[model samples]
Structures are given as C-alpha cells and as structure tokens.
Target: MTIGELAKRSGLTQSRIRFYERIGLLTTVERRANGYRVYPPEALVILRVIAIAQSAGFSLDEIRTLLPDDRAHWDHDALTDTLRRKVADIDALALRLAQRRAQLVTLIDEIEARPDDIDCADNARRVLASLFDGD
Candidate 1:
C-alpha cells in the first residue's frame, strides 16, 4: 500500500506517518522503484498502537524506547516498569478529570439555581467562582 492508502486506512495524516518513519518511531518501510513509500498491512496495527500510546500521554520519544525491534523481544523488567509508570500517569489524569467534572457540575448547578431576575452583571462572576472554587 502507498502512503496515501496507509494514511486513509490508518486515519493518520500522511505527514505524520512520514514523520514517524523519519524519526525511526516506525520501522523501515519498503519504497517503490518510483520512490513512493509502501506499507504492509501490519503498519496500520503499529500506527494504531502509536495513536493509543500518544493518547495515553506517551511522547513519541518515549514510545520509540518502548517499540519492539524486528526480533520481537523486550526485557520483562523494563516492560513492567513502563506499564507501572503508565498506570501512574493514568491515575493522575483520572484525578484531574474528576476535579474538572466536579467544577463543571457546580457551574451547571449555579446556572440552574440563579434567581429569575438575577443581575446580568453577576452571571460572569458566578461562572468564574464555579471554576476556581474547586472544593
């Protein structure tokens, strides 16, 4: 498959795919005689893994370290440590999300509780308070 076909199939931009290849985050891809990039079906799987890892807050540089080599072997201790670190990261994100949700809920409650004739000038203050008052 060509670069365009890989981008379409993997839901990534062609530039991003090429960027990964350039940075060695992706393995070497076969090039056509015409100099166009060609990808195998497995490349899509790797791309999806890259996307998920990124969403989980792993930087491309870090991901490169986690990437398996062509030999398909990894150090068990290192892999365990990486999983532990990722779990810690996810826990911190969950805490932040919970705090954000509480703040949003307070904002919604305040909006719902506002008096029918409340001064328009105070509405903005109420919202600001809801956001920063995180209790």
Candidate 2:
C-alpha cells in the first residue's frame, strides 16, 4: 500500500508515519520506481502495536527494544521480564501518588481546622508548626 493508504489504515497522519520511518521504528517500507513509498500489510499491525505499547506507557526506545526485527523471533523471556518491570514501576508510582494524595488531604484538613479566634497569620504559623514540629 501507499503511504496514504497506510496512514488511513493505521489512523496515523502521513507525517507521523514518515516520522516513524525516519526514526527507524517502521522499517518495512520500500520505494517505488517513482520514489513513492510502498508498505506491506504488516505495517498496519506494527503501527497498531506501537500505538498500544505507547498507550501502555512504553517509550519509543523501549518499544524498539521490545519489538523484534522478525516477528517470529521475539524473545519471550525478555518481553515478560520487561513487562513485569513496567508493572512494578507503575506500582511504585501509584504508591508514591497515593502517599502524596494523603498528604494533600491532611494539609487540607489542617487548613480547614483553623479556629475562629485566630487571625490568618497566626493560623498560618499554627499550621506550619503542626506540619514541621509535630512531624
């Protein structure tokens, strides 16, 4: 298929497909006699895989490493290990985000718990003391 057809089928813009080819991510392209690009049917699948991997948080470099030059020659163990590591990284990020969220909630509660008798400056000092000295 031509670059336009590939772009239509892959739901990617022509420039993006060309960019991928230039970046060595899409390497199955051939040039016609008139200098037009021709792509095999496998290009569509590869593009879909690239989009999926990207959505899954795999960077282009990581996807390049994970994708085998020959589809039949994928290293199963390496793929599994990499996926597991990504999952672990995501888990660690989730833990940190949850901790941060909890801290924000605590801070909100502290800020809202100001006494009516205190001025804003004194309440600010009280909050700071609780945050620093109480910790």
For all predicted structures, in order, the TM-scores are 0.67, 0.90
Instruction: Output the lDDT of residue 82, model 2.
Output: 88
Q: Using lDDT as the measure, which candidate wins? A: 2
RMSD, every candidate, angstroms = 4.0, 1.5
Encode model 1's per-residue lDDT on 1-135: one tens digit a residue: 888999999899999999999998778599889898888887887899789889889888878777777626767787678878998988999999999999778778877777667675687777667667765
Tens-digit lDDT track of model 2 for 37-84: 999998998899899889989999999988888776889999889889
Report lDDT (CA) for all predictions. Answer: 0.82, 0.91
Superposed model 2: Cα runs more than 4 Å off? none
Alpha-carbon shift of residue 14 in model 2 (angstroms): 1.2
